[model samples]
Target: MADYKSGDTASWDFEQVRRSQSNSPARRSQSGGSGRRTQDSQPPANRRRRKKRHFNVVTYILFVLVTSAILAGVGWLLINDLCAFNKEDITATIEVTADDTIGSIADKLHDAGLIEYKWFFRLFATVADAKDKIGTGTYELSTEMDYRALIVGMHNSSGNLNSDTVRVTIPEGYTVSQIIKLLAENGVNTEENLLEAAKTATFDYDYIDNNSEDISRLEGYLFPDTYDFYLNEKASSALNRLIKNFNSKLDEEKLAQAEARGYDLQDIITIASLIEKETDGTDQANIASVIYNRLEGPGDKGGTYGMLQIDASLLYALPDHTGPITNEDKQVDSKYNLYKYAGLPPTPIANPGLASIEAALDPADTNYYYYALGKDGKHHFSSTLAEHNAFLNSGDYAG
Candidate 1:
């Protein structure tokens, strides 16, 4: 090393030294020299990434515009279907099957010209929560109905052709003759045809076959229930429906239960008819117990003399007898007169429901021999005629 004096000058190619250091690879990399590339200059990885990004941005904008257009078109179509576009005065019938979905039903209505569009109907039904409420039937529709009206009409069963089908409710304890009149009143086939069918129509049931006497064979066999039948239906077919219902209700299990109680199906039905006439559904067992007790003898809460003085039996002889009984009424020469006969009547007086039949099959474990109607519209039961008379005269009963 040499110490520099004042005003001394030394030169050793300083610009060449700087140029060599700047040209090095490490310096070139840090300073980004002329040979270094910009983002656009590189055509391998970064350029591909930039191209991909641009393509993605353009594709996203295009996708959004296409989706928006599609949604708008669908919304317009739905609104058009829901509104009344072409109101025409026309009627159409659409048959809806059991397997028909709301969409299929809408298609049917649209094809029938009752509805404007199927898609709109499906959406409306879904929004109204009535998709599953649509019924299977032949519907009578008019094109005059609006969208909501059309949907509601389809959901209602009465809007269908099956509305002509009447609901015939045969109340319990109605006699065959009474039921005949009721059937006629409700636009069922004539009373004469119904009675003839009851007498002659052959039912394919074991219970019916066992006691197939032509006269009054269907007395206790017609199971009283609410039945749906086409208006003016065939008498035989209607009677067959009741007989089938009866056979179904009194299946093998019920028959075996009756047998276990030491009674056949006929005996149960006969007693059930009596109980049905004597009291309401609630007092069936009590009335049934009284009937059984009267049949069992004196020591068993019965009369030593075998006679069931049931007043309803007296009225059974007269088809339309009403109000209080007379002494003359009790002397009717019919075999159904309980005052003149021993044990049960030849057949039931009226059709009995399942509950009465059940009670007859399984009577309550009571020793009651008599029952009378009271002012409270309930049966006042007693073990003897004396107590029965006391209740009758004590003014506690309507009679």
Candidate 2:
């Protein structure tokens, strides 16, 4: 209790005082002497976080290595089967018919040992966007062919879509008989076999009406286009291909048009056949107008009396129609003779090309009831018989 001002210089043991303060709980904690460990003086959060980071890094590396191994193994399996690698030299004759789907064809290939896995092939087909590219035919495949080669080979033989194919171009106004003759001559099929197949083959078409008693039931349906047929192919197959092409041309748009025009496909085709035989391509739409006027329009006056008196209609009855019509030909008692029938023919006389078909669907607006081939190789339409007679006497043709 002595006052510091009195300046007492008596010194005690200072080391003993420091030792006594050090033993206290508050002093020990403050000086880090470890009476009881504080939160800051214990193992730090940063050190624990560093250990966790190291563990996460190891885990990420292991994950990447496992994923890479799995990917590599998967790629090896797909490539090996896709390329037919390490396969023995083998040959398999696979017949891909029109009825075969992706699954059926894959099954066939797998059974023949030409492929290993059907599911993988289906997946490849889906990825390649070739679910509908494979064609129908008997293909000879070898173990050396890869996935690309297999698809290319089956799509069209000889690795070309049209190579090694017999190209047959049917004219615009070609009859069924002429088409059969041309196809037969081009080594597509035998004429006798094609004739029989065409007459008897039951084609499934919603628009076709097979009510006619004729040797060629597919008269007007054989769309005139350049087609590539396999050599010595099945007659039915070739016929079906032509029919399919025709069906494709008459799409939903065309069908809607026909319905809008109040005309069915048969009527359109029959009228188109006549237009194809009459028009010289210069005034086809006008000729179509003349035909429409004569059939059912204002031009159906005393000029035609709703009797499309087209001389081309008589040609349908004559199988050997080489020259122009005569008076005797008009007397023929066939439904095809417009002079006797007073309406359209029983069926289309010939297969018309797209031009004539379009003209029939969309005719030029006119009052023409007659069209004559003039000397200028163009049609000269006339609304009256006097105008037609004048053109005939004008020396436009041999008439």
Candidate 3:
């Protein structure tokens, strides 16, 4: 308390100040606290908080990794299942009856190895809204189709392309009887039954009656062409199909053309049939001109001749004629014999094609009255009897 010197009074008391600071509450909180710790106690709290935060972060990271792995595993399993079900094999001949139900068709598909499970196919069809979309008919299935492909094929019309068949080609000149024989030879139908059906076949009398009365049968009107028939088709059906095709080819225009040419429809067909038998090449128009010239030109007398004198007509009249023509065939006796008759035969001898029919109506412009085939199969025409005789005497004459 006494002022000794200014320097002495200003000097610090280290020991006393330290003792007082130790007793202060604020000092205790900053340093080592009392029985209720200060910074030391806060250190324990902070360490506990940091430990909790680290545990939470680690747990969350581990949970996210585990979830990602589980999701990847599920996705891979789903993809594998889909790929396995996409490829399947099928095989068999399925005959779907007209009254077959969807359930029955599904069962057939299962039996044919086209579907792995019937319920699956049924469900798929139902889901696609195609339960009643399937058609009823014979179906051919193979083993290389999958579920989707098989379903599509079942609804596709072209899937029925494969089937058993018998082919018969009726030539352009064959009669109904001959057509029946050809069908029989090809195992398409019984010859007797086919002939019977053909005889009763309905025809357009308007076309046939326009020509002549000699063609009482359907020989020339029956069109000739190749036909494809199923194994299950009946003889009557085949005959009807041919007749229908023939009718389709004979339109009113062709008939009109014949009429315009100063010939009846039947007469054109008759002449066309003759031309078809006389000539093998495409020179039917020329042959038809020759025929008309002979009919109008001078013959043995000054008057017009009445006979056509066609060899094909004579051959058609032969009895028991089974093969090629012979020299004796020209001498056969029948109303169809052109050598004996002065005009065209009663009807067409054979069914003529459209080309021959057109040629008969529109003949070529020529003055030739006679013609004969040469050794090279070319025809030699003559305007008079003397020239025709010379051609007949040539080395090309088959007679």
TM-score of each: 0.56, 0.66, 0.54
Worst ten-residue run, lDDT, model 3? 155-164
lDDT tens readout by residue for model 3, 222-309: 6777777654344655655666676777657867876775667667778888998888666899889877766655665222275677
Sort every candidate by TM-score, greatest first.
2, 1, 3
TM-score of 1: 0.56
| Candidate 2, residue 268: how far the Cα is off, in Å | 0.9
Per-residue lDDT of model 1, residues 246-326, tens digit only: 877775686687788677878788999998888755899998887887776564443436577888777878868987888
User: In every candidate, how many clashes are there?
Assistant: 0, 0, 9
Candidate 3 pairs with clashing backbones:
90-143, 210-266, 211-266, 211-267, 214-346, 215-346, 215-347, 306-342, 307-342
lDDT at position 387, candidate 1 = 82
Task: Give the clashing pairs for model 1.
Answer: none
Q: Which window of 10 residues has the lowest lDDT sum in candidate 1? A: 155-164
- Candidate lDDT values, in order: 0.75, 0.77, 0.66
